[model samples]
Target: MVLVWAAASLAPGAEARQSAFDTRASHAVIMDYETGAILFSKNGEEPMPPASMSKLMTALMAFEALEDGRLTLDAELPVSETAWRRGGAASGSSTMFLEVNSRATVEDLLQGIIVQSGNDACIVIAEALGGTEENFSAMMTERARELGLESATFANSTGWPDPEHRISAADLARLAQIIIRDYPQYYSFYAQPVFTYNGIRQFNRNPLIGVMQGADGLKTGRTSEAGFGLTASAVRDGQRRIVVFNGMETERARADEAERLMRAAFTEFELVNLVEAGGGAGQVEVFLGQAETVALRAVEGLSFGVHRRDRAGVRAEIVYDGPLRAPVQAGDSVGRLEVTTPDGRIFSVPVEAAEDVNRQGLLGRAGTGLVRLIRGG
Candidate 1:
């Protein structure tokens, strides 16, 4: 049976729903890094051209390759003629100014991609890994699926405008989570301020790095079809948030919206620890056990983000089949704890027996049964 414990007194305020946050971007999503809670969303699930912001995927693929020994930082990859002709200075697009037929180390290429947004560097890495850019892009799409990205599709490593190239704002934030959580060592490349290749210097295009406190790594994108877009993450007071947005008319607009959403993400919400790990969740009646009741505990701490204004109430339910029959061992999975926020978001965690509950002897069990019958139980 489910036992609900509504914690209305935790915070003193009337029940209220979170107010909607407005944004100028056509697509946007803000998510808490720790809880993966979506603080705000606007057409976040719809697939749209990501422009160069998709380079996050390219960076992720390379990071994985380095992890599994498929590629090394110092490994040299040849710059093909196609890479130079299509992505080089002659293409009038972002380029690393790579000299055709010259080989560059994986380390330098990554800097080129992350810091310079070099289409040429991305192509070289693609060819080195998949033997061709087209094949590598297919690998990127497949890897995105493997990573559980719901709406990510890739047509090129550089994120050059292609009708088939698409990703959702939600997916972009999720991808950022992966890069930040799973690949911490390489993530610093995104924060590098400047990179020089072939005697020419370029600065990282991400606008938030220096402007926002605790802002670090990320990518920015823009194209005729996909207006200025950004996938950024920032940490403040030990909390991190990821923000993704697209379809702004100008770079300044994208920068403004990104900073605004990030600030609001932190200021407008509060992360509350509802229950501590190993803390008592609730109690459950035990049947034919030496103990009349058994305590329940959460396997892990439970935390949720609630709107600051709506910290009004949080409802939790301790659900289990009871009275549970003994003998119960400590740490046995017995039930689950369901926590609901004022905004109607529910978070669940498994609960377990906090102590042993040995079965009562036959005579004791009989006596208990008689007593229950007398009490009309």
Candidate 2:
């Protein structure tokens, strides 16, 4: 027989459901860093121009190189005519002002790319690592797939306009999570406020750095095709969230919307642990066993982001095939717990027997069998 029972109730202090969020951004996603749970999304999966925001991938490649001894921060890389001509001061785009054929250490190039959003720095790194920008971009596309950035594709190291170069807001947020979780040492470079090179200094393009509380590291991108976009992360009271948005009308709108979305991420949503690992899941009837019941426990904890107002609709159910035959061993798979949120998302966690339940002796089994026969057929 199969058995089911309610396992959870409304969270404390939950309020009435509120209206869904509205935003002017054409694409957006907000995620909880710790749980990898998406808090909100609108057109987040659609591929769109990433602009300089894709530099996060370029930076990621460099961080991995440093980790495995393929490259050193102090090692110098050369700037070629292509880098200086196409992406330097003459290009009327972001640059590190590198004189053609000059050299800069990997560390300086990183600061240039991150804090200055220097296109020249990106090209230099691309050439040094992959022998050419075309080859390097191919490498970027390959590595992006390996990193599980499903919507990411690379056509150039600088994220310059290209019909093929595209990434979605959702993938950008996932990439941000990967960097913050795997490369803490290199991730700090994103927080740098300014970079000065060759008698020129430029401020970081990220708009959230100082204006938003707990805002630390991230990148910003803008182009005629991509519009204003940002991929940013913030931490408050030990919780971190990553927000990616694009297609805003203006830089000011991007800034304002980023702050607004991030504020809501921390204030209006929560990571709720509905069921804890090793906790009692439910009780199961035991057949011809020493005990009448066997306790079940969750194999792992279940958690998800829920809107504050929707907490009242959160529900958990324990489901099991009952009357388990003995001898039941501790940790045997018994059933699962199913959770349904207000948004109709269902999450399930496997449950197992919490303790051993041995079979009863022959006499005890006979007596129980006789009682059952007398009560029924």
Candidate 3:
């Protein structure tokens, strides 16, 4: 059967206050990882040039290959003339100083891409994995779709300037979340400060990595067309936040804006546990069942992000169709317990049957029908 859910505000006049954050970036988004709630956003959905930030998608492809055994970390991939000329030293882009016709291990190349923002390394991996950079970009676009990145498109392995090579700030944040969630084993490469290849050592370009207390790994991007962009993630006390921004005027602005946004994300809001696992929200009547009623409970704990000052405005309600049919399983869905906070955020948790309800015997069913008819149920 189909169910329709309606939104209800739990607290009136408890709307979240406007965040006092001001950033120089034209597009930005800050999100809480655990709750998937957007803390602050400014033109976050507008697509803009992602520049080297697109390398995150490139890194994601490599990580997936590593996880699935299709590519090993120690596997050596060849550098193509195309990769060398266009993405290497000849192109005047970020390079890992990779030698033409030389081979680099997958692990080192990944470091080159992550730590050094090496456009050459990205092209090499793309060529190795997808037969050519063009094909690899197609793969990247397809993978972005598979991962639910709606506004992301890849024109090249390196986030080179292309009119079509654009991604929204929100999409970048989602990509960052996927990378951190799916590739924990390889995520540390993003945190590495420096990588030395071919007697050249380069530091990670991400501005927040060393300066921010909890900031760890991520990517930075810059091009004349895209200005500057950074996708940064940080964790503290088991909570993580992802921030994405683009179109900054300079590197210093990106760094300061990113840090301010991260700090506000962690400090401005609080996670509220509204209901515990197996906690009963209410009960529902049972029709033609051995028991007259069944208790409804949340299958897991329910939590929400709330403005710290508006804690008392949180409200919860249990909603479901009344008088459930008999032969109910212990975990059968009964209804939904919805909680809403002051900041206009709504969270819903499934409410399930607390225990099984067996169908009544023939006589019991007949009696129940008669009683229901007399009571006009």
lDDT (0-100) at residue 364 of candidate 2?
93
Candidate 2 lDDT over residue span 1-377, tens digit each:
54545556654333334325656888888899988887776777889999999999999999999999989999999999999999898999888898899999999999999999999999999999999999999999999999888899999998899999999898999999999999999888888887788888788888888788889889999999999999999999999999999999899999899889999999998787767889888788888899999988989998877777767766666677766888999999988887666554567899999999999999999998998999993
lDDT of 1 at 290: 95
Q: Model 2: residues >4 Å from true position, as ranges?
A: 1-7, 11-19, 45-47, 89-92, 280-297, 313-377
Taking all chains together, each candidate's TM-score versus the true structure is: 0.74, 0.77, 0.73
The C-alpha local distance difference test score for the whole of candidate 2 amounts to 0.87
Q: Return whichever of 1 and 2 wins on TM-score.
A: 2
User: Candidate 1: which stretches are off by over 4 Å?
Assistant: 1-5, 9-20, 274-302, 310-377
| Candidate rank order under lDDT | 1, 2, 3
Clashes of each: 0, 0, 0
| Model 3, global lDDT | 0.82
Model 1 agreement with the true structure over 294-316: per-residue lDDT tens digits: 88889988887666765556567
- Which of the two, 2 or 3, has more TM-score? 2
